[model samples]
Target: MALGPASVKNEGTKEFDFTARDFERVRSLIYRRAGIALADSKQEMVYSRLARRLRATGIRSFQQYLDQLESHADSPEWEAFTNALTTNLTAFFREAHHFPILAEHARKKGGPLTVWCSASSTGEEPYSIAITLCEAFNSLTPPVQIIATDIDTNVLNTAAHGVYPFERVEKLEPERLRKFFLKGRGEQEGLVRVRPELRQLITFKQLNLLEGGWPVQGPFDAIFCRNVMIYFDKPTQGKILSRFAPLMKPDALLFAGHSENFLYVSNAFKLRGKTVYELNQGGAPVRPANPGKLEKML
Candidate 1:
């Protein structure tokens, strides 16, 4: 997903002639393609983000653009359509608490650990996991493998490259900067590249969570599927979580977003900590948060 400018108006002045029907069509298409439950409040946000696509395609209006999308269902533009609408706002250690648990798991599991970062927005979370694993093993080459997948093809391309602005890493300690990243020079100045050690440990791919079957082979020790669930309705969330359970080891941990409370959505997982969950056996206590009911998501 593209995290475009905050301003809703084109050139900070001209507003796209968006209509209620246009918003409804776009919302329906996005839900069908990406399983994102865009709220009615996001109408303006939808217009702002997709306005660029309209300009690029030389389409006069959202209605026509949407008509084109529906007519050409298999076109490459379909991917771009989903990419523009989905949210990709993420950063390194956005949920800092989850890393320590991952580290602890790495220590306990000893050699050859596997993890899946289910929402690899521009690759920060997976890289952070790689760094943690490297630190745990005290080597650039750790006995860990990470698979980072995201629905957005555009972001996957960026994540695969493993390059970012220097400011993105400015918060890290100097020692870590030196150990895990290479400072770019000359034309590439003010940029940092994740070291080959870290990059090699991760396999980045594009994956839509709503797909019928996944290409990944897993009994992963942990899965970081945070933030993305907020866009899904309760039933969709529950179905996805059910699919995750079989792919994960019985003792595997699941890390969720701050706002997500899966206790009411599914019975398969028990809350282990703040936004952390593990597969429930039989008598785990019930603790459901007041996760609001699913809106007309589909």
Candidate 2:
């Protein structure tokens, strides 16, 4: 007799009775709520993360916990469930090449500019944008606005605080260190905080892309949706990319992750440079690139 999904069970000696069905249920729920398609190989990972939720909610089995969640569509626990499964991986200037492209675009635009960092994850990416523009325009305050958003509320709270361990920025150049952050002292030792000016340039909020209502308005100069679409399936990626189309200006630039090739996903954009994209003009005799991709002004 061959084994089936329902017949499989987690190996012996566990705190909770986790089975293949329990994992499948989790996969389905998270996929519906967040558009994340968890793989069968992620069974161990899923059990580990949600095991704490089971303890906190005082549920004996995964079945009971999931039953509770499905029973109440509006339950606050849904937020916790979503947050537990979401992954946030980020760093300052993560794909270093994109920043130079951004700085140049901002200079050419030469006016009040707006950019969106759709996956704001713990805030480093948006702050990096602020820092780039500040150096580009030679002002602590620049004529720019950045709206940074992410699905994970837990990370947003940390991002809003603007405090981080010193080790996080130690690798940054000495000039960048002095110019942009204040070293923590006394009781806050070993911590560094982003300068107030950078924080002022950003507005952080909770956003779920899978949901219908997006709270942002844009015909933005640039939009950074880097490294986020890898979590969603192809159909979901296409839907999100189509929505991003109407939100972009005719000449707007889109920055994507190095490993992400969106050419297959939508025709609204085309490759401009490595991992960087711009709106497709459909051969309509668009404006020249010299005005848009100019040499540094400072």
Predicted model with the maximum TM-score? 2
- What lDDT is obtained when candidate 2 is compared to the true structure? 0.85
List, residue by residue over 86-166, the lDDT tens digit for candidate 2.
888888888999999999998988869999999998988999999999998989899999999999999898888889899
TM-score of each: 0.90, 0.91
- Enumerate residue pairs that collide in model 1: none
Model 1 lDDT tens row, 1-298: 2224422233545546776677778877888787798776686778888999999888888888998999997989999888898788888778899988888988988889899999998999999999999988888998998999999988998999999999899998899999999999999999999999999999998899999987687999999999988898776787788788888888899999998888887878989999999999774433433356545432
Look at candidate 1 and tell me the lDDT of residue 227: 92
| Candidate 1 lDDT for residue 164 | 97
Candidate 1 whole-model C-alpha lDDT, 0 to 1: 0.85
Q: After superposition, how far is residue 24 of candidate 1 from its true place, in Å?
A: 0.6
Alpha-carbon deviation at 287 in model 1, angstroms: 14
